[model samples]
Target: MPAVVVVGGQWGDEGKGRIVDLLARKARVVARYSAGNNAGHTIVNELGEFKLHLVPAGIFYPEKTCVIGNGVAIDPEVLLGEISQLASREIDTSKLAVSERAQVVMPWHRLIDRLDEERRGANAIGTTGKGIGPCFTDKVARRGIRIVDLMEPEDLLARMRSVVDYQNAVITGVYGEKPIDFDACFAQYQEYGQRLRPFVQDTQALITEALRSGEHVLLEGAQGSLLDLDHGTYEYVTSSVPSSTAGGATLGVGIGPTDVQRAIGVFKSYCTRVGNGPLPTELFGEIGDRLRDHGKEFGRGEYGTTTGRPRRIGW
Candidate 1:
């Protein structure tokens, strides 16, 4: 079966969530390939309104399985919370799986993340204070903790302690902030690890098997293409590839240029951007306020799933 990748054509929040929910009916599996809880897809249907962060948007479909791919950065606590919310709605999340290879977002990451944003001061990128950027940083720096690492409580504790000590030194000494309690942070993640253990999976194996069986898949991105780190608008971009290229690379599909028979990009009629970037067409003042009021696009109430900041609304 063919694989379809849906992504935002501009910055974050371009109605990609609605499309994902619509396509979920035909896909056997809907996979989230990258980013973290920093970006989100809000879906409104007859069932009700939903804001999906960690898990795939296809969780709404009872027949479809949602896979969180390795390229993603996860906060187990956040994922569990999302699962609980879904269950409350009588949604079956039994098919949801977390890639063992995905990196785990810990307490220290959140602390440093906020501190980093604070340091930016007036030049703030408007992060959601969710530790996503820091988690990605740890991954690139080769000092990240993966879901597999959480399997060994001893290793998990040791690693957290080591990272915490280093981070606390920088935070207190360099950033001039109070030190974070190593024990408290460690205990919190331990609980998350315990709760999320059941969902950890070998995503590569599972995805390969699904493909071999000829099941249709949908690879979804949290943000848009222009926010892609490599191809987006310079330093203002998000940390991953929010395009078809990213889908193929991270998911191990190895899909090439010609392999893409059809591709559709989604964007809203209005324009919106979050964090630091060049929003050439941003509307503010009374005009922007009008859009927020009339269109109901305002406040931190509607934050990005991966970035965690309230979306900047424009028209």
Candidate 2:
């Protein structure tokens, strides 16, 4: 009951990452609760500017324990690459932990994501093609491969093959795309398992231990409250709730809603949304241009870290 949640007050890109990075100084544990690589957190610190997708922004603080919680769908390649990048900069990432219960974003998931989005055509959801939705779909459908599945060779192979077979059928039959090669996918993940095993653990227990010991915990939310699957714009929202207002952080991290003692909503001077959605207050033309210019959305800028598309800014 001593957790603090930092959530996006708008349609994401509300500077939640910077807030979490600053607040993490007072927290012993910082945990990401929802979304995946589809969501982005661009943190500019003394070391450098790091655009975080999966790893918690709290990783900057060597003293804090950062966790990829159960609510997160992990893309191993992205996460591993991010870790390598950080390590290259002399950043200490040994304190990070990946939840055993977190969903895995497999190769098929990424493939199907792009294929399906292309099929949508005019109705495309403007996805980052990072497979966040598909990975969560498998999680809800009970066909997900968890982090623990990667630990044991037999379990990993069996689970990966089962899901791959079904997904491969959809990929070829429905999307008319090439099916994911099971052997190749399996081999790649086998290497990923070896590299990721050290960070995999019972993150729920770790968080509980930190809480029970009276250590301050920070729960970081991704996307935004208005993009919540159940609460936001239908068909336009994210696949999961990434806000503490809807108890997403608790559910994502395997904790109770009551455990969060405070929730800080981060907001910008203006509203901005990245993906497809009905943004009524959305601005365009000169005002929008100036907003983008001031926010540095132009050039090699920080408009949409996940999609690299210009954000729809408004009042």
Query: Which one wins on lDDT?
Result: 2
Cα lDDT, all candidates = 0.75, 0.86
Query: Candidate 2 local accuracy as lDDT?
Result: 0.86
Q: In model 1, how large is the Cα lDDT of residue 84? A: 97
lDDT of 1 by residue, 127-209 (tens): 67778788888888878888887877898887776677777787899789888887777777777878888888887777667
Off by over 4 Å in 1: 241-262, 296-315
Q: Model 1 scores what on Cα lDDT? A: 0.75
Model 2: C-alpha RMSD to truth?
Answer: 1.7
Q: 154 in model 2: Cα distance from truth in Å?
A: 0.7
After the best TM-score superposition of candidate 2, give how far the Cα of residue 156 lies from its true spot, in angstroms.
0.8
